[model samples]
Target: MTGVQKLENSKRNKIQAYDLAIHDWYQFILGYPPHLVRHYIEKFGVSKYDIVFDPFCGTGTTPVEALKNGISSYGLEANPIATFASKVKTYTDYDPDLLLEYLAYIRRSMESSYSNYGIVEPQADLFSYKARFCTIKVKDIINLTESQLQVIPKGFISPKPLLKVLIIKEIIRSIENKDARDFFLLALAKFIVKEAGNVRFGPEVGRTKPKSDIESIHSFTTIAEIMINDVQKTKLTGQAQIMQGDARSLDKYMTRELVRGINCVITSPPYPNEKDYTRSTRLESVLLDFIRNKRELRGIKENLLRSNSRNVFVSDNDSRYISSFSSITSIAQEVENRRLALNKTSGFERHYNKIILHYFGGLYRHLKTLRPYLARNCKLAYVVGDQMSFFRVLIPTAELLGEIAESLGYRIKEIELWRTRAATATKMQINENVLILEKK
Candidate 1:
C-alpha cells in the first residue's frame, strides 16, 4: 500500500472485535492499537519460532500481540506501573475458574468484614454518587505513608473509595499465591484508574471532573469478572517476557541468551513532547508503592528516555550521541531560534531545543545498545510522530530518527505514514509514521 493508503488502513483498522482479548486490560488513552503491532509483526515476517523485541513496550501491546500470534517476544518498559501492567496482562497461566473462585471468596470476606464495620455494600447504581466529599466516616482503613500520600494530588481519590481500595489492597496482599495476588492487585489498579480516580486522559493525564465516592466494590468485582472471562478466552503457546528497566541501556535487562535470538523489533518510543510518561501512571504507581517520594519519582524519571523538558537535568549528557548529526543539531537550533523570536522565556520553553536533542540522543543510545543484540538481518520498526510542540517549530521526528539509524549502520527500508494527529499547540497535522530499518 502507498503511505497514505497505509495510514488510512491503520486508522480504519485501529480497533477490531478481535483486539479486545488481552489488550483491553489496562491501556493508555493514546496507546497505539493492537492492529498496528500486528501489522508490523506480520510485515517483519516474524514467525512463531522467531523472537521479537519491543524496547519501549508501554503497556505490552507488541508482546501480547506477539504471544497471541504464537510468537515469543520480549518487552522493556521504564515505568514500574506500566511494567507491572504489561507483565500481568500478558501472563496467561492464571486458571480462569480458580480466579473467579478466588474473587468470590475475597468478595464475601470483604463484604462480611465491612458489614461488621457497619460499611454498606456499594450499590449497583452507585456510579452516580456526586457527594461533595465522601461524608461516610471510615475508621481503621489501611493508610498510606505520609510520603505516599504526598505523591498523590489532593482530592484524587476521596475518603470512601480510598478506604475500599486500601481494604482490597490489604486483602490482595494477604493472598499466598504470587500470581493471584498480582492478578487481584492488577485488577484493583485498573479499578482505581478507570473508576475510582477522577483523572481523565484528554490524551494527557489530568483531573477533568470531581468524583467524591466511587462504587469501588462493584467496579472491582465487574473488572475482575471481565478479566476472568478474558483469561479463559486467551489461549497462547508463545512466551511474553517483560523487563522493568530503561530502554536507553538494554544491557541491564537484555541477557546474552535473548540477544542473539531477537530477529525483529517493533516499538513506539516517546516523542519530543512535554508529556511526562510517568505521570500517566502516577495514581497506580504511587498507590501500589512503585514511587513513594520525590526522590523515587525523580529516580524513575531519570531512567526513562528523555523526551520532555520536565525530566531534563544538568547531569543528562545524551545529547553527545547526536553531536555529529547536523540534522538533529539543526532542529535543536531551529527550536531555539523560534523560542527567541517568540520571546518565550520560561525555563521549560528555554529547554525545548535541548529536549529535542536529548530525545534523539536517548533514542540513538538505545539503538546503539541494540546493535550488539540484533542479528545481521534483523528488521526494526519505530512508530514515531512529528512534533510541533516547541513554539510551533515542526520536528520531523520519524525522518530524523531514520537518518540517525542510518548513521548507526542501519539501512532505512522505508518511512511509512501510519496516521496523523493535530498538535494541540500548533493546530497543525502531525504525522505519525513507522520508520522501517534493517541491520546491515
Candidate 2:
C-alpha cells in the first residue's frame, strides 16, 4: 500500500521488449534481458560520473547496458568462455573499419573455396542444414587441409583464443542464408558447442537436452554452418567495455588507472548445491584450450559467487555459521561443518551445510568490501533465489545481505521479488529476486 511497496511491485513485472532485430554484430552467450538492464539504469539515474560494475559479470550484460547510456563501465568474471563472450559484447569501441574489411575478406575467402569445401556429404541428413543455410558449403570438415586454412590468417595478439575465435567466426559467417534477424544470430553465436562431439544446445527451458543429441551433429561442418549464419546475421548496437578478469582480485588484472569506483552491483551467484560454472563450460574450456582436461576445469574459483558452490575457502566467519548449525543438530551438521573446515581456503566439494554458510558469508564480504568503492547515493542490486537446504528455510540472501550492507554503512532500501523464467525441475530452475541497496 505504501510508495515503497508499489515501486517494488512494478519492478517485479515481466518486461516487454520492443524493436525488431536489426544489428549484425550483436551476439550473446548467456545474454541478459536488455529491458531489465535498461530498467536499472533508468530507475537509478546513472550518470557519467558514475561507473557500473558486475562482480559476477556473466557475459557482461550489466557493463554493456551501462556503456550504452554513456556511463563508463567495468566487469569482472572468471569463466573463460563467459569471459570471451562478454568481451565481444562490451567492446563497442571497436574499429568498424577493421570489422568491415574483415567481413569483406572473409566473404571473398569463403566464396573462393565454395566447390572445394562443398563435397560429398558424409551424412545426408546434415546436408539439409547446410543447403538450407548456404549456396556453397563444406559438407565434410575432416577433408579440409591445413593449406586451405592458411588463407584465413591467425595472430590476433592472443595465443590460442584467437584461433578459437577465427574458427567460430568463419564457420558462422560462411553459412548464413537468412535475412539476419537478431534472435537467429544470438542463437547461433551462442552455439559454439554445435560442432563439438559432446556439445548440445540444451532445452529452451532450464537447459536440459540429451547428451546424445549434442554428440549427433557435433562435427566441423555442422558447427561451422550454424555459427557462420549466426554471426553473419547478428546485429549489435550500443556502447560497452567488457574486460575479462577476476572480481575477487580486480587489482591484479586492472592497472592503477582502469579500475573505477562502482555505482551499482547486480549478480546471481551459482546455487549453493548446484553445478559449477567451470564444469558447465567444460566444452568451451577444452575446445578453446583454456583448461587442459575436466579435472583441470574443476574448482576454477574466479568469480563464481561464494554462496553457490561448495568450492569456497573456509574462513573464520564460515566456522561461526557451522558452529551455529552444529549447536542445533548433530550428524548432518557435523558432516557439513567438517566439509566447510576441510576446504579452509576456497574451492571445495559441494557441501549442503557449508554452501549455506558460504553463500551468506561470501556475499557479506563482497558487499562490505564495496562500501569504500561505491559513489555517494549509489544503488546496489542482487538477483537471488533461495532454496530449502536440509529442511531448514534459508532466505539469508536478502536478510543477511541487508545486515552486511548496513554494517558497511549502506542503506538497505528494498528487496524486490521479480518473478523470473525458470524450469520445472528444482535444480535448473531460474528464481531471480532483486535486492536493492543504497549508499548513504
lDDT of each: 0.82, 0.48
Per-residue lDDT tens digits for candidate 2, residues 45-151, read: 77776777777777666776666567767777777666665665554433444333433433334333343444222332432222222232334222223433332
Candidate 1 overall Cα lDDT vs. reference? 0.82
For every candidate, C-alpha RMSD to the true structure in Å: 4.6, 9.5
Looking at model 2, residue 3 earns an lDDT score of 27
Clashes per model (N, Cα, C within 3 A): 0, 18
Q: Pick the candidate with the highest TM-score.
A: 1
Score every model by TM-score. 0.93, 0.63
